[model samples]
Target: MIKNFLNKLPKKQVKSAESRDGGSLALSSNASTTSRINSASGARSGNVNSLENNSTQNSGVNHGNKLHDPLRSKANGSSPPVPYEALPGFRDVPSAEKQNLFIRKLSMCCVVFDFTDPTKHLNEKDVKRQTLVELVDYVSSANGKFSDVVLQEIVRVVSTNLFRTLSTQPRENKVLEGLDVEEEEPLMDPAWPHLQIVYEFLLRFVTSPETDAKLAKRYVDHSFILRLLDLFDSEDPREREYLKTVLHRIYGKFMVHRPFIRKTINNIFYRFIFETEKHNGIAELLEILGSIINGFALPLKEEHKLFLVRALIPLHKPKCIPMYHQQLTYSITQFVEKDCKLADTVIRGLLKYWPITNSSKEVMFLGELEEVLEATQPPEFQRCMVPLFRQIGRCMSSSHFQVG
Candidate 1:
């Protein structure tokens, strides 16, 4: 099974530039060694038979001239086609030799994004983009059961400065270069598609069943979680959509990190509210927190209750209430559902932050007040009824309603 799976790997077709000493390294067969790697990968997933049966012809390295070296052309000031070495057909090359080449090529592909200098590293954006696409494709084709070494390398690259730089906020200058200067500069800029691929790679890493345990134990840490939360403020709606799923997956898989994730989000919310920081993905983050709130254990802790009172409740006071209204309402309702005694507190908090100038918001408060009233038990409802009706009376008498 190991030999067969290795033979199915796409061999590197690119020829190395000739050395000054003029000696080419000979490719050798190491069937015995690769069989060991295949065995280990198979043992890790316990599904080698499935991998062999699903192998297809389209899996080979036939990405055209995309594999050419970018630096060579940059130095010469003229585009030249660099010939790539074609892999021998499955029948022509021994399985062992193909396996050895496959392992070596995979290693190089994983290390391509490890450059320390941003200028030099991003210059080869095309190569890095293609390599990432190929890696994603290979892993997907294998049903997300790649070798641990390959997975580790991919995690390392995504965690590097290069990937972070590409995934950060895109500059207009970079976008214009992709548009006017060089058509080949698509991935060189912080284009949404390129960032989407990086995010998709991360989504795959966290969600893949084969890598779930390792990802939870290793990649999902405090610093990584904070980075993800920071990315939640991205202005690109598409990027934020992808980030929403990635973050939810992190929250779902790393159960131990749940408290910390919630705390970090609380800090972000506090900044957005009290400190007046702008965050584009606030609605998305609130949506995730709503789900987390739904799962809170009964007789909730003081900190959790405080999060609802301080963070979740005041969140409604933001000018962009409609953006997160649904999520915030759900979270607030979940708290009331957890304990009826808290209903009065929630009602009082809503009245405290009730909008004064916005008639539409006054109307929204009525709707929310109606929901909170429905959730309150008879005693709690009676207890809070006076203040609620007083606030209602104020809304009816407001000058904005008189005009309407």
Candidate 2:
């Protein structure tokens, strides 16, 4: 039947037909539309949907080869710099077919060395670490040819297996037990080079023109970038510094590509500042935010004052803000003079006193009246406060501030 005929056909012939027929090898058409199809066996469908939604589909336009190639060779004897698109050994074999074959081989490697086998990989420690790193590397290089569906499935399998392996490893008892892992030279250290390779692949892929916006969105999705950032501290200083460089390039390239990475960074900043559990972590977080605001403001297009105001509004509400504000108020009142800057900071930080809408003006006016009365000024001041009070009463009666 059809299966027998397909099986009998040459591999190249089958692939050509599959690509032409919009079968397993085909990318979704650039029509900004999607149709559901039940996947064949283990083939993933998610990348098809992702590509259809985020790529040429959403934009409803196809990118032609007409776009100028920045990597193109110059006519004159100009400087010859390496192109990002041209990886080592990528020049001789430029066809998409070759890329696909590379991806398939890497994917098979992950399947062979399963990390989730606790009994085999448990407190075996360094051996397990080295093996898992190799698996991650193999799967991570699957950037160029495999559809998002294929890449996602591979990552899912790798991450789940690695997580299980790491979880089963006996917890280190002494503070310094696992800290000296880098001092010993590796029996192979094959993992290090592979890790760098995979990391580079991911970095390039996410920022590549070939990747659609929808797929690019997944790069920073669910705190993935932050999680990657957290991984740096666990490495040796040199390796950690190298990873930071890679992360810097990734984040920078993302912001340059999409521009919305600033907002993403801002969101991260808010979490670091207002939501993080560790109090000492605040200074480092603030420095990072300050660096972002100062260095990348134009690219970020952030509304600094307005963004702070917006963040403050939620924090002002009593039920919403933490009880720490109340305790801070007490601490400030005990330590600082009545009219001191610390007292002002505490009060301003604690209250969302500014009315969000005109409807709250009456309440604001009442609070103002109490404040003026408490200040207990001279007769002339009292006379000025009285007229202000009358003005507030008139505005309230007339409803001039409200919109219909």
Candidate 3:
């Protein structure tokens, strides 16, 4: 029976069941770092020198006019001056103008990057770097005359590729000739802006009061998050940290500042938790779920409360759990307190639909529920509790005889 039950179970479901029902566990938000684990990890390559060189080359060229631009590279004179010499957008620019544009735009993104990162506590010795200070000036004024499109492109390019790669580079390595018998494992990377700052900017832009649907469509794509998830699963510690940090912030933003984002987050998590069936990832996922609860449980909207309540149903099955029920019990306890009215409604509704609980297991499960509630009741309700205890006692007496 045990083997058969395990066979039908998916990891996320099992974890949800185990944790939601009463399983004792403290899930971590950090991605699993075991090097041997088959989780997400990888990176894309873009050479800094090549990009810089291309930018440098574009700065110095100035085409006179599109119709008769003499500065245009002469297509092999042999071939009737090829109609289009250079590509459309790369026509021409003043060297000084281009350099100023690059620096000005690059500097502005520095502000965007800072804005995205949450302000961290700094020590007395922590000096504010000059570059950081300079960034503030650029972003503040560079876009005054420029279009939002121009500002966005600048933010996208400069922010996306930079600082992401450093997350995964291994620090300590064996000195091949040292001939030491033992090797030391390196410390885990510090989590911060592991993902590109563009993600934060895109999210901010999307939620802005003046958000333009057309413009937002161009930059903010949910698919990017899927790729991030894939990278996180690659067993690369750096990628893991990056993905974790990004998701954490995204989740925080949704729960705190953007309640509208809850739908999107729930959709993303559902895909991972249900559609993907990647059960081994349950522990970390539970942490994410816990964070969601911590942030939104208080003063939850009725609609949201119902949504959360329904979401927990899939987690109640025995098939999802392999052992203890402490995690599930604790989570339910939190939900009960946060959404007492809704929880009561749910428990009453469940009792109504519960197909005749004649089995010993059902009786015991109901009995445990009663016991938990009774234990948590206040002394002031001690008199009222007597009736509840009496009713439960009657149910147990009858249930015991039927089971026997």
Candidate 4:
């Protein structure tokens, strides 16, 4: 009978009740909290409990209004943006309603402000900042699975904030002939305040127990991974650090994406080696690759061997090797360690790129060769030792004291 009466609530009467009595919505929210409290306490016999139950029973009209808000909004999505003061937060909202509230927050954040001009939307900017913090905390402590809609909302909001075209590099960042990176100031992102929080939220969400890989795969797919890889070029080291960790996490958890990640990174290397010769995150990428190369199975697959020969070895030819030489040396050494037989191939590759004209590069190559030789067994050493000793003789004859 109660169900029949609720089914019979005419839309006009429901709207009229909510329109004339503004307190009904707040009453409904408070009544929900009170009923939850009373039921959890097991207070079944008291008049207070009876009164709470009656109150819950009377809020049906207000509940209908909550249900009606969605339909009305859909009827007019072209409505101007919600005022900054009217934006909702997840705090104190019922757990069951948090998902909807989360969507609203994401929608509001989708409107990217011109962070370059601080004079714009001061209050609104702070509101979004606070909203992002709440979101980060909510994702961190969330106990249940994220709904599909929530996952899409996350990607949309993140894409809006993270995937913009970064400004051009300062002249200080260019590859000057003699200036060290320490001589110049670093280019930091102006919007890092909000960017950092969003990055944190994404990192936690990716690693969260509630994020099922199967569902997450839908939004965090190949195109998503590609765009993320592009972020490795960001001039801001802090943002690239976040990208490095997040991409590493994605590569680890999303098993289906593994092969593609390797291939795409190889493409990045190919471009860096052959085309652009300029990228900010080469060291970070190689850092991630060091961990990955460590995990490669023994008697390695031909594909892995090809990567070592084609990409890792050629990484030595870049003018910027000094920038990433440590990581490059580690990755190359990992390849040789997995199969000592590759030491000969690696030694020959190193010798092929040895710099006679550039004394500093000759010194770096000598250091890398020392580390590689430490892992080289007798058999592989014999294969390349003849030319290797020849290079040592050449280095000893060099006019540069360091090479000698």
TM-score of each predicted structure versus truth: 0.64, 0.32, 0.37, 0.78
Candidate order, lDDT descending: 4, 1, 3, 2
Residue 191 shift from truth in candidate 2, angstroms: 5.4
Q: Go through the candidates in order and give each one's C-alpha lDDT.
A: 0.55, 0.32, 0.35, 0.68
Tens-digit lDDT track for model 4 on 220-327?
Answer: 999888888988887766677667667766766777777888899999999999997788889989887776777776568888889999999999988877889988
Q: What is the lDDT of residue 264 in candidate 2?
A: 53
lDDT of 3 by residue, 82-138 (tens): 121211111155543643554443432232112121233111001112222223233
Pick by lDDT: 3 or 4, better one: 4
Clashes (N, CA, C under 3 Å) per candidate:
1, 1, 26, 0
**Lowest lDDT 10-residue stretch of candidate 3:** 121-130
Which candidate achieves the best lDDT against the true structure?
4
Report the candidate with higher TM-score, 1 versus 4. Answer: 4
lDDT of 1 by residue, 307-349 (tens): 8888988887667666567667877887898778899899999
Is candidate 2 or 3 superior in lDDT? 3
Cα RMSD for predicted model 3? 18.2
